[model samples]
Target: MTGEKVSFGFEDVSEEEKVSRVKGVFRSVASKYDLMNDLMSGGIHRIWKSNTIARLNPQPGELLLDCAGGTGDIARAFVAKAEEVRQRRGGEPAMAIVTDINDDMLLAGLEQRGDDGLIWACADATKLPFPDKCVDVVTISFGIRNVVDIPAALREFRRVLKPGGRFACLEFSHMATKEMQAAYDAYSFNVIPQLGKIVTGDKDSYQYLVESIRRFPKQEKFADMIKEAGFSKVSFTNYTGGVAALHTGWAI
Candidate 1:
């Protein structure tokens, strides 16, 4: 332990501890992750993900590296969209590699919906296993907040992308209006943990998750961070009045 404090939810913990706790949280919730996501967002998360995939505009023969890709949701969707393009035109099959630090999360993805054109690996977001400038697209959905060194991870995302390649992130973000923020806080603090307990038998994990979202940087600030990570043409679009946001940039 370098005695470096990192946010594990609202609580401060050592970087190593944060990593271990995050891994444990995912491992505990791995089996019920998708169900919890649907329940938490009232199935709107699907629409958000669909919007992300559409914005990414996955092309045939492109490679997508989905860091912190739990249960392969984004990976599967990316491959499917790319395949649609390939089938319509003529191109090589696109590949999506789903990587998460938690082994159980990877296992859950493989067990739940293993599909062709998708590869699963255990990887840390801050230190990806692949060579630099190797992938066409890099995406992390609803997962970057949990990373202890977000800037480092962002740099890694840029590092793995080929020049002109795109990077997109979908994350829970700050709401636009004070009224909306108030209402969202009420529901998030009051309701989400209970739902977690009912569904996954882990209220604490959900509590941490909620806090993590609040701790995450707001839209404009995060976009700046992406730019600072050596990406250009960075921008962000808020979804559902900023309940979530999609941030995009180019490696160049």
Candidate 2:
């Protein structure tokens, strides 16, 4: 992966360069990252996340590793659900670790939510810092596309999960209908950058985001990639006309 070139927005960049470039993009937008998500998705991002949590069906005492869990949204959701189950059953809450490659994003998350009993760490998705079979579930929400080596990251996710553990990912995906796709393309390419500039005062970062979403593999292809990474029972559920999707598999 050293000499090979990967994508940075619409441009092709060396693997090392792409990593730094993506980190820069997140750093630039870190201050307003959550706000940008709200604006970009018209608050539908929350719904998508809630649906992910529903599908995840988090259990008490299950450890969850949320890779690239920017601002700890997914981690928080998992923890909250775990706590709910614990309260009903009179047990302890599950553990959650929120990991991201960018310190700025992690720091921003700390500022907003103050840890919430979560372990916040700056760790790369492609090479996690966990031992084998350490966690019961691994999740990445709206973050996998930024990974320079997605297959490596998927393998890492599989490595960290215990047998029968689950891996779930929620990300921007291909729209299901042609008309919706056309409208979404026009909006993403046209309106998102303008919103970013107006809100975050950064247009290029949002442009890169749109391009990266386009570069991510479609749903079926991504599921295949997960299967190739040694996961079983791989499946995906598209939300909001496939604007976002949740892919789940078990480390069987």
Per-candidate TM equals 0.98, 0.98
Per-residue lDDT of model 2, residues 1-252, tens digit only: 667989887899999999899999999999899999999999999999998898889999999999998899899999899889989986767999999999999999999879899999999999898899999999999999999999999999999999999999999999998999999999999999999999999999999999999999999999999999999999999998999999999999
Q: CA shift at 74, candidate 1, in angstroms?
A: 0.5
Name the TM-score of candidate 1: 0.98
Model 2 local distance difference test score: 0.94
Q: Model 2: clashing residue pairs?
A: none
lDDT, candidate 1, 140-248, per-residue tens = 9999999989999999999999989999999999999999999999999999999999999999999999999999998999999999999999999999999999999
